[model samples]
Target: MKTSVILNQENLGSVLSNVKAPTYDRDKVTTSIVHIGVGNFHRSHEAYYTNELMEHFGVLDCGICGIGLLDYDRKIYNILKDQDGLYTLMIKELDGTYTAKVIGSIVEFIFAPENPFAVIEKIAHPDIKIVSLTITEGGYNLNEATGKFDFSNPVIIEDMKNPMSPKSVFGYLTQALKLRMERGVGGITIQSCDNIQGNGDVAKKALTNYVKEAAPELLSWIEENVSFPNAMVDRITPVTVAADKEILKEEFLIEDQWPVVCEPFIQWVIEDDFKAGRPAWEKVGAQFVENVVPFENMKLRLLNAGHSLLGMLGALHGYNTIDEAANDPDFEQFLKDFMDVEVTPTLGDLGDINLDKYKKSLIDRFQNIYIKDLISRICLESSAKIPIFLLPTLKQQLRNDGEITRAAFVVAAWCKYNDGVDENGNTYEIKDAMSDTLIRAAALSHKDPIAFLKIEAVFGELVNNKRFVETFTNTLNMLRINSVKLCVQKINSSSTSV
Candidate 1:
């Protein structure tokens, strides 16, 4: 048996010979970015990239000061704090091999709830050039129907009332920007690494709208001083499980409290616009594009939508993880058809990206046996995901009279999955922000077939579309009688793309 060493700065030298540890001097690194919502994805993607830049390109100025803004963030905050902001990043390769790297980019972590002022002060610091966020799609606090900042949120209301003692992300950002303006600090970029399309633009609107109401004086300063640049980020990072920890301790001889595991593939396509300055991340593999829309569209439509398709259908079929469902021949075929028939036409110009190769790679990635991406993780906050990832392709298909069968089936699968019981009669918790509403509508679908679709917040005008309604209704009815697996096979074998 190998000797196990706790993963921290002190034990970095004692780690297994194969494990890659940060070679840079930790004390010499300084924070140029204050990142909010330091979750698995943030650690696995943005922090990983920054660590590479520092390690390979000698970019020490771009070190990150991680901020945890949520109550759930306390867990990670404690872990990273204990380990001195050091954690293992286990990359599960497609060939079923593992590569371990100790990431040291997150030089410090601040739990916002402990001292909100400390968090604000860090963002306001002159050395901080970028305030980055990985606060998921729903965290933006947007009115889903209006596609704008929601002032009606109780948290937003409370933050607006007591600006100094703020709770929400925007409130903290606004207060920090106010301080920055007062201190004559130069402009900074607010970079959003969320999966939302035009994420930076959304961040700009949400922050500016909040500033417009809460601190009208800061609006002009923000307009001139702040920049929000859109980015397209891609990686398959699953939540860390106990087995991952065991593997680290037993196989790698590293004891990590919270280590992140992900697929080897990673991509970051950022808009080439930054106000203050940015790390030479392009030296490390990040693509800096003039426009990220074309790339963003390809990812959101193909990769993201494909994940949702597998997740919803996989859950209903009683599969516990994405790989389990993706490895199924029937499910694999359905995903390919969905990508080729329904989603492809929606993507107009992808510049030079080969759609066929991209789609094939997506299938291969999903079926990676080493990356045990939980179905529940993919299904989590799906109400927010479906609208942003899958709905646009669906709307485009409806307008062009293209293939709607696969997309409609995925919606039906979502309705069925929300019932909180799979075909095997095993109950699982429906994890979503709109869980109650979704379950209620899904339960009502048994009697009123269109009840789920009538959820105006989710389906919107799609409920009014007769062809979509008929197809969705039929699929939902078929699902009620047949197994999810059977329905998938039928959809795959179907002659028409109706």
Candidate 2:
């Protein structure tokens, strides 16, 4: 029997012979990018790319210093700190094979709540040229109804009042940039790696708005000094569980508290607009584009929207993982139709990418049986996800008079999913920030079929559209009376394009 050893810098030499560990001297790496929100996706994508650059291309200057802002982040903070910012990244291949690598790109971590000033100072440091973020779709603090930065958040209000002692990302950024300006540090980049379309524009809007209110005097300086670059990042990183750790120990004789598990695929298309400097990520297969909108539109509409469709329908049908749902012939055909029929019409020019192949690849990735991406993870924030992922296609289809049945079915399925009970009467907790409001609205759907659509924050004017209202109400009514599988099969069989 092989002996399991704890994962840290000291044990790097003692890890199993087959597992790849970082070759570069980690002590020599300097923190040049301060990334906020060091979640699984960030570790698997950005940090993974950076680790590659450092390990192979001799790019050690652009090491990442992770910052965790929320109280929930304390768990990751403690885990990574204990492991010396080192952890395993297990990539699950489609053919039931696995590859493991210890990522050493994250050189340090700071839990912002413990010492918010330390985070601000770290960003203010002249060496830190890029302050990147993976704060999720809702982290931008945008008002869902107005689609703009919301200043009324109590935390924002507190940060506005107590600028020096900040809580929110906007506040920390404002204070840090002010310090950098005062100390004569040159301009830096504020790159957003979130899933939102026009994420850079959103970040610029939110930060500038916060600065305009908190310290109007600094807005001009910020405009001159800060750069927000748009990026399209893709990697299906599932939440790490104890079984993941157990697998590492049992198979590889390695112990990791919080190893990241993901599919073999990864893609990052960034706009080449960093101000200070950036890693030569292109060497590691990262695409630096002149404009990321086309790529982002394709990804968000096809891949992300497809995930939401599978998630809502999967949860309703008692399918626990994405692969379980996607492998179903009925669900597979439904997803393909959703991509080819409903979403493709809304996508812009995607340069040279073969749309058909890309769509096919999405299905293949989704069907990766080894990854086991939880349906609940994809379904976690449907309230925020639907508008960004599915609604655009629905709206565009309504204008062009294209297929709306699939998209409408997704919306209806989402409403039904909020009831917190699947078709089998098995109850699962609704995991959303707006669960209460969503559940309350969904509860009214039985009486008033379009009640869930009335939440202006989520559905917008789609609730008022006669065609959409009729289609959505009919689909929602069908879902209330039938099993989710029957609904999926009916939609798949009835669609003309299929």
Candidate 3:
């Protein structure tokens, strides 16, 4: 198929006229890898890296066959198809710098639920060596209480029974594996790019447990053959907006169906284990490390956790965007103090690096106005996010017989925000992240903060800890009476604030 340049030299005459866009033959592209979630994050981070690999190393053998699991994702599918699976990615730097590059790595797009058989056949194809996923935390059938697989979830059970439905990522993958095994096809690497701790292990557990319960023979074959490589992917890609689209079209003179804009900084670290071999990603900027735990911890706990801190607190203060929250003096000081007092000590040595420099860079990243990271978007799914992002630090502080007052303040502020009351004491709709449970808990315990924390699914074993229970209960009570800002001020000014 002959491809035409969407934005030619005449269209974008001067602003970006000197940029020499790389070209690729659509017919030469082959589906060597299939990605489950084709969201903006995946397109900006992994797909872009794969595009660079092909451009620099001349390895166009691998092209992503995009898969959309949810019904809502059909819109994304349609948009990409309109563009012939071609899109431009704009990388925004903290110092007001930007670069635009057109990505042509996705060869074909498929909706798994709409056409299960076709997705399965594509996965079963011998050339598709790797199947990577970024289906978000909620997509996994995890029990809310223990942070483990919810074997009892109805959707999972249905998928387990009717594997051809390919209702879930695990179901689609396992079903494809079953077909591959029957046809004597080699195993593919299961790579997870989610934010969960030990993400690859979690993916492995979900798939293996499901297969063991549903088909023991398949489980045995998977254990013997497949490799689930743990990875850490870092790039902040907020959902696109009209203004962003206008900027792209007016400034760059390109009509992108779904343009992805993200921070220029990107990081990908893998566990160096692949069953059917992998791309030469390191030739670009992707990092391959023996141990990904340290890097994962540094990103998850520090960057992601800081994002949560700004999110809940930002909402409580009536700030719409993360950059807005960073502009407020109280929120700014609260975040820095929380980082210095709470998060810094818990993090181990990060590859002989300066901790102060990392913290400075993180702060600067949060203050970017180009990408309006919505507070509400970040605030959703606190149940899954808080445990991985914030709780470990609190637990570590407890182990050392130290206080997590500021950290406790974050939890209290979040609970108050989840109470279905806005900063003005007006009711607002809360979406996702245990909305019903949190709302009911908040309304029922309007006078008692402890009642809200008793929900086992959200708090889990952490609520039962004597020290944490006392600290959290007291902090919540104080915040309920004095409000977040006042309570935080009191804590920061206290003699034993840290």
TM-score of each: 0.98, 0.98, 0.94
lDDT (Cα atoms) of all candidates against the true structure: 0.91, 0.90, 0.79
Local distance difference test, candidate 3: 0.79
How does model 2 fare in lDDT?
0.90
Return the TM-score for candidate 2, rounded to 2 decimals: 0.98
Candidate 1 at residue 251, lDDT? 83
- 2 or 3, greater by TM-score: 2
The prediction achieving the highest lDDT against the true structure is 1
Worst 10 residues of 2 by lDDT: 489-498
Q: Write the per-residue lDDT of candidate 3 for residues 208-284, one digit (tens) a residue.
A: 87787767789878987788888888988887878777777666767776788899878898998888989899999
Summing lDDT over every window of 10 consecutive residues in candidate 1, give the lowest-scoring window: 489-498
lDDT of 1 by residue, 1-498 (tens): 568999889988999889999999988999999999998999999999999999997888899999988889899999998899999999998788789999999999998889999999999999999999998899998866567787889999999899999999999999999999999998999999999999999999999888889999999999899999999999999989999999888888999999999998899999988999999899989999999998999999999999999999889888999999999999999998888888889889887898899888999999998898999999989989999999899889989988899898999999999999988889999888889999999999999989999887677888889999999998999999999888887888885853
